[model samples]
Target: MNVLLFGASGMIGQGVLRECLLDDRVESVVAVVRKPLGFTHPKLREVVHEDFTDFSSLAGEFKAVDACFFCLGISSARKSEEEYRRITYDYTLAAARALPSNPSLTFTYVSGEGTDSTESGRSMWARVKGRTENDLLAMPFHAYMFRPGYIQPLHGATSRTRAYRLLYVGVSWLYPLLRRVIPKHVTTTENLGRAMLAVAGAGGAGEHILYSPEINRLAAEGR
Candidate 1:
């Protein structure tokens, strides 16, 4: 399978990219980024593009793509709604629109656990994410929304956000206990990556929106 990946430098993206590279079924990975990932693999191809709102020039890269892992996102903390919406909604929609209208294409989006599907919610991020999810589901491709809560970054994957990094550092030792206590609310980067691949390869089954428990189950099934 040929894959197109966004936010390959991010923590979740890093895990997905690693899994894609390791999977024998994956032929190649085209990662779109503003800067190089600095990590090289024979199957990895990096495309440096500055503007996420417009992807017209990168049309060639979108051709013949079997799956797209849209992991690009930003924390809403300390940012205006407009800024968050631009990155979350606008960039995602632009990429979706840029891809060819193929039903065979599997488009997986990484949303948070509390994302609103109704497009109307008390939380600003949830509402925007809901609208994005709703719009993507309406698209022609086989779209899947993954909502993972309390993700444990495995295999050296780390968040770029300082606060998130600190939080992970403080909570890393408690992950095992947390998983045992609340397995449904927790997942790992490895599990999330494998789950995406499993859903894509299966042509999307069960539910369009998968929570952490479903994500973990899919990962195990894939293995």
Candidate 2:
């Protein structure tokens, strides 16, 4: 299987990229990044794309991929709704439109836990993500929106945001306890990556969207 990935430098993207490399069933992995990740592997390929909103220049590279793991996300922070929407909705949709709309392609989008499907919510980020998820679902590929809450980065997957990194560091030891107690919402990066791979290889649990619990369950198939 050939896999296409976005946001390969981010927290979740790193994990997905790692799993794609480790999985023997996968033949190749392509990551579209703004800069090189300072890594090399026979099965790995990187395309430096400066503009996320315009993918027409790299149309050829998006072809013949069995799956795409799109983790290009950012905290809304103090930015205006338009700024957040540009990155969350516009950028994601550009990539989605660039990809082939085939049955063999499974597109896994990393939406957060509190995404507002109604697209008219109190939260700015949630509203944008919700609209993005809804639009992607309307696409032709076998798409799955992965809504993971409180992901514990594993196998060297680190967050680009300093606060998030510190938070993970502070609570790293509590992960085992958290997983056991609130298993439905919290999932490890390892499991998230494996789950997406499983979905690309085989049909998922008869569901287009997957929460943390379902992700963990599907990831177990790899083990």
The lDDT values for all models are: 0.94, 0.90
Q: Can you give the TM-score per candidate against the true fold?
A: 0.98, 0.96
Worst window of 10 by summed lDDT in candidate 1: 199-208
Candidate 1 residue 22 Cα shift, in angstroms, is: 0.6
lDDT of 1 at 101: 76
Best of the candidates, lDDT: 1
Q: Model 2 Cα displacement at 129 (Å)?
A: 0.8
Q: Per-residue lDDT of 71-187 in model 2, one digit per residue for the tens?
A: 889989988999999999999999999997686688899998999999998998998999999999888888899999989999899999998899999999998899889988899
Q: Highest TM-score, which number? A: 1
Pairs that clash in candidate 2: none
Total backbone collisions for each predicted model: 0, 0
Please write out the lDDT profile of model 1 over residues 20-128, one tens digit for every residue.
Answer: 9999889999999999999789999999999999999999999979999999999999879999999999999999999987888999999999999887779999999
Model 1 residue 66 CA deviation (Å) reads 0.4
